[model samples]
Target: MILRTEIATILKAPPIGETVTVMGWVRAWRGNRFMVLNDGSSAETLQVVVDGEQFDEETIRGIGFHAAVSVTGELVESQGAGQAVEVIAKELTILGKTDLSTYPLQPKRQTMEFLRENGQFRMRTNTFSSVFRLRHAVAFAINKYFNDRGFYYLHTPIITGNDAEGAGEMFRVTTFEPDSAPRDEAGAVDYGQDFFGKGTHLTVSGQLQAEIGALALGKVYTFGPTFRAENSNTSRHLAEFWMIEPEIAFADIDNDMDLAEDFCKYLITYCLENYLSDLEYLDARIVEAEKNLPKDKRRPMGLLEMLRFVVEDDFARITYTEAIDLIMRSKPYKKGRFEFPVSWGVDLQAEHERWLVEKHFKKPVIVRDYPKDIKAFYMRLNDDDKTVAAMDVLFPYIGEVIGGSQREEREDVLRQRMQEMGVHEEELAWYLQLRTFGGAPHAGFGLGFERMVQFITGMGNIRDVIPFPRAPRLADF
Candidate 1:
């Protein structure tokens, strides 16, 4: 039996000599004679030339869009690129069929908004199939790039009593029922009586625990789902998102940035070279809506150049004070400029980040030395005592792609900061002990997996790239 081959492979080999069997869905049907079937292998469709003589009326009339089928036919060379090879099917087997009466996906274009509503069947669409394949390739490429560099892949705990990032955005996953839950003398829902004998919440970031293993192993990376309860419904925000964090012991902020740039460039280059076919589909069909693209934005740049550009590129390193000064010098009462209001010692918003990276510097910019009040407590305090050694890498399209900082290695400083922030010291003994016993000047960054997708594919929204997004008012699928 001729096992089914990918359409891309068949397209590459021009002279189709033997009979081939392709299994996929009926993408479109024209008249009673011609039909196009997408084999879920590639963006290109197979010309399923059905004949009434050999096939029954039920077989011919039963097929519809997204209907799974197996086709065996003789391969013939074609005169076009996407339509390169033509499969003249001799026997067609129906595998599975979707009820077209209720099926929302037609042989037409779908907006990203509409597609979000029907995520289950969205993978069957041309654009999403390409997006999904490229996403898979990029994720695998991330693992490959890190693993090849002798990095330990670590899995951190999800439910934790300590908040790692200190963002106060953790989702409480408790078993305490509101109706019949054990209460304290104060009549409040007694979290102490809950599971684990204490109140536990889903982890907001795995950086802290992952740092422990990194300290022991010298280098480690974690790829896992991190939950946040920030109530943010934006183009780039997700309630639950995958974070790729690599913590390196004995590494400073500069070393951490180098690794970040190298990792980002590797992911991009891996996709451009290995997943070119999938990327082409995403660029050709999805983002541009199959429109003809310009030359500069045609394909992504080479990997090494991308990496070098990120590191050696004109990186404008400005302190938080300097950034605030720049914002203050800008239009006092401006019209059609500076979307978000910015002031000194204020946390930068998404629009401000976009301005700094997308418009001001027009390249990947790293803004460091943020005020201690606005930065995390674990970040090392500078000699100035006002600003912490924290940094955020803001790219052009996607703002704040990577966030890292030199950790507070001093035990006294860490305890002081934790005390100032009113953190539950009893719960963070293990973490604080890392500082006491040979904790080097370590650093790491959390790269949002969806933001990486946005950077690679040029997809605008986070919802578009993820298979199943867990947002505020979504997730029926």
Candidate 2:
């Protein structure tokens, strides 16, 4: 049997008269003459010319949309316009014939929601294939970016006893029967009798554990799945998502912000340089998607334009205080356009952040020194005692892409912050000991992998960026 060449490879360098075997699903079988095939290798598909007279009735009958097939043919320059080369099929074998009457997908345009419901076949579509390809590109760029910078990739535990964010929203990890489990004297479920001998839940973030690695290894990162049990079913929220967190020792808030900006630009630039085809497809996808929307509702720039602008421009940096002041002084706030109320101590909502990035700065913005009360317990306390040395990197479409802080390394201060935030010190004794033993000033931030993908791909929903999305009342394959 002859080896099969990938459509992507053949398309990249066409051997004008060489015979090659290609295997892929039929994207389209037009008038029983031309078979468009794609093997998920690249966004482009290949045209295989089939002579109805040369093929028997059975072989011709087997060819249809999405039917798996292998073609042994002579490669030649195309007489067509869209593609440069074509395959003249000398032999055709049906690998798997699809019964189109029952198949969920069609060649025509389908709604995203409908496509999402049929996720098993969604990748076969152009939009999703491009999305997942760029998704892979971004993942590769993430590891490459960190590895090139001398950062080790650390795998944090998925089932963790510690809630790094102290948000009390976590998916419980238990082997016990939920309705009939051991109970303590207080009538609470006896977590001590459970799998790990105590309460444990899916980790919300890997920043805390990555800090340990950073303390020992100088620089480390964790890129893995993190879960949250929050009931939000919005476009931006996901029950399970991947996080890329990098922790660096001896780094303060300034260093953290600089790293965040540089790292983001690098990811975008890498995609632009290497995966322009996929990006171009997604870019055109957005342009076609937003054609009907009102002028103000549409994006200010096209996807490629926006991505290049982000990579070329410098991110604006300001304190949370300055951000708040700017928002308050903006015309929208003056006209009471925002739905969420903005105040000094309260957390900044997405609307507020969007205003700062999209309307005010006209570029990516990093807002630092958020009020201590609105931040996590581990963030370093500023000298003013009112704010923490924290920062959030905001982009045009996605409000916050990265959030990080210079950790509170002072053992006493961490203890006080824990108590103030209602987190039990006994539960994190080892965490405190890290500070007591050899903890240096460390900083790290987490980039929501799906959010960055969504931003880069111009995907409207966070769920669409991930292959299998987990959301409220959603766990479909």
Candidate 3:
């Protein structure tokens, strides 16, 4: 019986003179003897050698690029440079074959745009494989972090009756045919006749449901897919993405910031320690990709250095009002470098956020106490009556990594804010009930999973980090 081994494992410590079977797709076939094999197990590939005397010429030529094959061989010291060991094939079985003419992924370097169009096969590429592997590491680290911290993992519903963000940017879920939907006397589509008997939509955030779990269980978190129907075609926005929302009972906004900081640092430190090889690969890619850029625009630190900086350094903590003040007095605002002019009460654009994290602070920043008018209705109202206890965690390359706040636990204030925000309280009666009875101070935050992956992988576009990106006009796998 041939012992099957993953290419990643075999490449780690090649067993000289040991018989083994390597099953993988042929990455490249050079001459009649050498073949590079990859099994989606790691960023590294294993080199397979076919003895022309033992293997027939027809069988050798049949091993096409990306063809699934199993090679039983003796692991011997490599006669060539680069790799330490090579497999001397004694038997070769072709599992599957691909037509090179139709294949989108070639052995040569392909552009990110081309890879995106062929996202289905992008994982086979070194760059994307590294990104996806790092993404997995980040996700695992998050689950481990919260799991070790005595937090319950809550699974929230994907379909909901009320918009969690209250932004109304939700994809309506209905069985009714839109062209022939039931109409009322007012000539409107009657949602009452729908399958759910009420208007429902894809959830925009899981923070509300997670809050319920936190109240009962003390500390809880939700890691699930969330949808937004915004038609933004930017690099930051996504139509469908994953969110990491952690809610804690008896916790204030300060506690929220503490958790956010620790959580982000944990993820960064975990990735750096566990995924150094893949990260180093991605870091090299970033360096090469940015080589042609202007000196001023190039990233100051490589991917590894950036991760270390976040992990080792303390995040700058400042209030939103103070950030605005700093921006107003800074050279960027004075020189009109900001695309959106900075002012108090104005929402900070990506430029402003980059200025704080990348330029001004030069580290991860926690900006809290945003103007209540610019924040969600559920945020705790501060004593100033104008600002809410909202905090946003900003990273160097990525602007807003996490957005959260202390929930408005006071029933009266919540109702007034809901009314002012024109949220139908009747639809959210259950959410209001949490505040009405035995409520304690609670806080939570939402972290964009893909954005975090993009930052760690050094990928420019959000679509590149996600496995199957769902964005404006592009949902193809």
Candidate 4:
């Protein structure tokens, strides 16, 4: 009978002199005597001392890189330098053997692009293993932070009729064949005969549906997958991604900003307190990766230092107009180094946003009160009539981690905004009815879950943080 003890548990508190059984894939087989094993329980691996004389020639030959095996061994203090304890194998069984010649992954360092191609075995690598472990930690921290703050987790529909962002870049959900679909008298595709009886898509944002929950339950959040059909092949864009939207009733823009700051700090703080070892591994990985880069191209701060600074320091708050002013006066803008033009009504590009957070403020920033023309219709109209009560939380590496605003609670104002923006009022009758009936002043924001993970793990590409990435021309298991 084999009752295998996890490598993480045995490593945490070594049961010296006790004979135990451990099962895992061999990480390394150094000198054919030291077998390092890991079972995905933690980032750390346990070393198994396998005496070639004790094991049969076949068993010793099977122990190679990433070979699955079971070993019953006596735990003892290590004679090596890295780890504190080691296991002296009494019995060894080869469960699965790997042929290194055909294996895609090698013991030596591999490029991230190659690792992404071989995602089936990427998590076995230390870099990806640490990245995914922290991804899980950040996700767990998201729920804990919301649940502890009395926010209800609302599961919004993945397929929805409304375009919350009015971007019109959504993946259509339909069963009809593209060439042969029902047509109306005017020769247009008739969506009325579709499965849902109307056109629907994978939702781009869940904030609108979550608003209903907030109006009824006080504070609610939606943490689920959303999709966009845009053809953006950038490090920041994703075809399918997760979002965290928290809506609160009776809250203004100021209250929303305060919640955003506190909630972000809480998540970072939780990961720092609980998953420090994994973070340290990732931090060292970044340092090694950036060693060949020029001084100007390298990151200003290390991964752990940047995370701690974000949590400890206060995020600078300013209006959209103020941010524009700062960018216009920046050295990059004056020297014609900025790629995109900066102005009042124009939306802030990544370059402009990076300058504000990295050069001007030197910290995270919360820029509020964007122009009404560039923002969504749901944002409340400011008293000035030119801007809306919208806000975006910008971070050091990532430009915007969170974007939210005070929603338009007034029925007439919402109607006017919708009309001006060309949003059909008939489709959103239920949404309007909420305001007409019992809607109160409410505000909310959405944080891209992968972007947060990328920031924490210091992974260069957003696709690296997600397990199975969905992007333009790239969809693999």
> Candidate 1 — which residues are off by over 4 angstroms?
30-32, 52-58, 79-82, 285-316, 328-336
For residues 1-477, write the lDDT of model 3, one tens digit per residue.
746899878877777899999898888877768999988888787889888888888888877778889989899998898688988888899999887788778878899889888878888878888898999999999999999999999999999997878788999999998699999999999999999999899999889899899989999999999999999999888999999999999999999999999999999888888778888889999898889999878886888888887888899999998999999999979998878987888999878888898788888899999999999999999999999999999887678889999999999999999999999999889999998888989999999999999989889899898988898898885
Model 2 TM-score (2 dp): 0.97
- Summing lDDT over every window of 10 consecutive residues in candidate 4, give the lowest-scoring window: 55-64
User: Where does candidate 3 stray beyond 4 Å?
Assistant: 1-3, 30-32
Judged by TM-score relative to the true structure, which candidate is superior, 3 or 4? 4
- Please report how far candidate 1 places residue 311 from its true position, in Å: 10
Per-residue lDDT for 105-165 in model 2, tens only? 8779999899989999999888899999999999999999999999999999999999998
lDDT for each of the candidates? 0.79, 0.92, 0.90, 0.92
For candidate 2, what is the lDDT? 0.92
Q: Model 1 — which ten-residue stretch has the worst lDDT?
A: 298-307
TM-score of each: 0.89, 0.97, 0.96, 0.98
Given candidate 2, what's the lDDT at residue 217?
98
Off by over 4 Å in 4: none
* Deviation of model 1 at 237, angstroms: 2.0
